[model samples]
Target: MRERVNQDVILGALALLFGCFIALYWAPIDSDTGIAEKVRSRWSIGDALAPTVAGVVIATSGFFIALGGILRGTKSTLSAKNLTYLIFFLVIVFSGFLTMRYAGPIIAGALGEEYRVLRDERPWKYIGFILGGGGMIFGLMSLAEGRISLRRLILALLIAAALALIYDLPFEDLLLPPNGDV
Candidate 1:
């Protein structure tokens, strides 16, 4: 068990370190190619940019998660490690569309400026994010924190959906994700 924990921590950390270097070099592309740039005729993301950042983010998350597992040692009853892996994988897969749809408003908010995306909602996109993501998040939590039961799973899923709704609905009038329907 200890050996496994050490392996997971070390491997995850190495992956994250590699990804950090990749992102460090590539993350700047967005600023270089964004609307403010007059260097190119039009704004365009370099092909390497998105994947690099995503890799970095995933690696970073994986590191923390692995390290967390190491810290917890062996808690056999309900293990969410696999679930964590799945959620992280899904997030990395979706990060591109998620970033494009949500980063602007997030950045603007951080900068204390008003911003809006053309539409803050999209049917399929919203549905997938809410339902699919919610399930994963809740399922992970279920597996991690306590015993999993039908009632617990339902409750967790509901909580996840509600959390998404809270973020989506309250912000509709103010700021919505780029793909979020107005």
Candidate 2:
């Protein structure tokens, strides 16, 4: 059997690297307008933290993934199972985001109350944080041509919980999101 090159890996790695560059250097340091504009005139340390970390992680992972693809070459097929898994993963992501963005407002309205702002972003943020981290873990571990295992699920949960805690607990009062008013 002949080994086939995975163009997706190479292209994806390159794209990730480019994204890292943009996020770390070129992306605007502050929000374009509104209260956020008054809060952070430039990328405060807190504002830059998430993107910088994410970009580095993605770029590093992309490099290893492309390398692995080159080394362990195999015939790639668009399998129905993989497609279904991908669709499920995407749905989970989009739903998490929608819930985060809408749930607060909906709940407030149902209670016949209005939030000081349009919505409270924290609860939804917590949900999204956990789900996002877990989705990533699951996608990389099980969806990527790997056999599912209980160990993986446990590890993913642990990792996701740790990440949420790291983002939400220690920095709760000290840091703010990019759009947050200081």
Candidate 3:
């Protein structure tokens, strides 16, 4: 009997190596600023912060995935079903993003207001983020559970609201997606 390489192990190893390379070398060399810095007595994120955090997260996820594969002792292969799920997931995510980007502008336009001008204001700013983000949560949950429920919709909206608050309240300078673009 021949031993087959576990897909998780191979994928995880590649991710781990890629993440390490990014975090250790690419970010430091490419970025002009450090991950964080104090500017005029205010702490702020620098150019490298996003890439560094992403790398760390990828490495951590890879470590756990590899460990799980090792412990499970099962060979898993990517199949057509997995590809179908991936496509579905991508579609859902892109749809959600499109909603997030356009919902505010469309609603504002319908209400005879300009999104770019009113983006910083209350209600307007939260509209797209909450609706689109909630929709995303609802979609993903429905996809996973193979059913859509009112309860899930409510929960997803609440979670999205909380996330909007979390992002909005802390960073005064930060602009939500599409807001920056608009």
Candidate 4:
């Protein structure tokens, strides 16, 4: 019998390498600020903080995944079904992102206003994020459950709204996706 390589091992190794690259090379080169900075006698997070932390987390997770697969002697391999699911996921995510990017502008234009101007305004600012984000959540949940439910739809919308509020409320300076671009 031909010995099949474990998919988890491969995926974990790739993730570990990618994460290490991000944490070591990409983040340092791309970011203007260090992971942490001292500004006016106070320590603060810098632009590199998020990517560096994410990289470390990815690397750590990958290492554990690889270890787990090795210890379990699992021979799991990718299947056509997995590929289909991945493609579906990508489609759903991209659709949501497209909606997030364009919905605000389209709606603003319909209202006889430029999105760039209204991107900072209330209700107007949240239109795209809420719709697109909610759609993404709903779609993902539906995919997972293999069916759609009114409860899921409502929960998705509420989650998106709550996320918008959480991000927008505390951080006055932050711009949601596509807002900065527009």
Candidate 5:
């Protein structure tokens, strides 16, 4: 029964990854802003695809690590709870990344260019942390059976904190004028 559930989790994660990739790559680039309207552009395909690639890689790695844990012993594997947490973390992480990418210019207009740049730089790091810490949590939960060490927990906490702090930093005001400017 648990094995079946684990299989489902793995399959679901894979499906989500594929969907995101399709949306990002194959989807039509907007006429005006280009894919820049979709997400932060690094002015190159590689940069644009980096986070998606990283997500797929980490999620794939977690799948293997989880399999290894189960094979070792069901006693040493991740529970449904752990998988839930992993999915939840990933959803928020990617959503935050997307929010910053598309909304950044408008936000920058209100805050300032510096804030925009800072905001632009954020999604990647958050993605990295989610992939890194989330992977570690899933792996350790699988191998240790809810026996994660304090240090591992702290690391994840730190990554979360870093992301939050970066997200909240205030930008200098640059509100748009009501009247059309020449």
Candidate 6:
């Protein structure tokens, strides 16, 4: 009975994985930023960019693939050494999440000043700013954990600092529409 259940689970996992791959290949492109914007890259990580929004959506479904790969690669050893790996993974996850949440708003606000949109004008916009900021904080924590290379960590830190500084200057009026939409 146990063997049968395990077989079922394995089959289900495989089915899900295949489904995700299909979706990623077939999903429609985004209207606003286009497909490329969805997968924009950060300089800190060399040239590696984010996945297309469709890619993110599909790749996220492959969590099981990642889990299986990690499990298979580690040789099933229970040791104190494993704690370091666990912590490092957690830091990366946290950092990525926070950065994703805030990066959008921060960039928007920076652009808005040229377009005359106030950074603080809308409540939801503020939320994006917070998320992006949180992501940067997480990236910093990840660096502290030594998961990212020194160069990458420094780059991430610099980008975050620059972004924070950009947020301080008055940008709303500069970005305002000629008709004065604000």
TM-score of each: 0.31, 0.34, 0.59, 0.61, 0.24, 0.24
Off by over 4 Å in 4: 3-76
Candidate 3 has its poorest 10 consecutive residues by lDDT at 1-10
Q: Work out how many backbone clashes candidate 1 has.
A: 7
Residue range 1-182, candidate 6, lDDT tens digits: 12212433344366556555444443433223333333445323211123344455545555555555445432333445678767866776666655555454456666664213433454333434345444555565655675656566566556654554465345543421111222
Candidate 2 per-residue C-alpha lDDT over 9-121 given as tens digits, one digit per residue, 9 for 90 to 100: 76558867876785666444542322223334663344555566666777777777777767765466656678898897787566655544445445657778653353236
TM-score ranking from best candidate downward: 4, 3, 2, 1, 5, 6
Candidate 4 lDDT tens digits, 1-182: 32388878888899999999999999989999989999999999999989999999999999988888777756667787999999999999999999999999998898898888888899988988999999999999999999999999999999999999999999999888878888
lDDT for 89 (candidate 4): 96
Question: lDDT of candidate 5?
Answer: 0.48
Best by TM-score: 4
Best candidate, lDDT-wise? 4
Q: What is the lDDT of residue 107 in candidate 2?
A: 62
Model 2 spans with C-alpha error above 4 angstroms: 1-74, 116-166, 173-182
> What does the lDDT read for residue 17 in candidate 1?
76
| TM-score, cand. 6 vs. native | 0.24
**Relative to the unseen true structure, what is the C-alpha lDDT of residue 51 in candidate 2, on a scale of 0 to 100?**
60
Worst 10 residues of 5 by lDDT: 173-182
Ranking by lDDT: 4, 3, 2, 1, 5, 6
Candidate 3 lDDT over residue span 1-182, tens digit each: 21386778877888898899899999988999989989999999999989998999998888888787777754556866999999999998988899999999999999998898999998899888888888999999999999999999999999999988899999999887768888
Give me the displacement of residue 87 in model 1, in angstroms: 10
Each prediction's whole-model lDDT (CA): 0.57, 0.58, 0.88, 0.91, 0.48, 0.47
Summarize candidate 1's per-residue lDDT along 1-182 as a digit string, tens digits. 44443555655677787777667654555444422333457655555667676877878887886777678654344246777877765664465345445554555567775444313434323443454454555556654665557776677557655766777766755432334432
Runs in model 1 lying further than 4 Å from the true structure: 1-126, 145-147, 173-182
Candidate 3 TM-score versus the reference: 0.59
| Residue 163 in candidate 5, Cα distance off native in Å | 9.7
TM-score head-to-head 3 vs 5, winner? 3
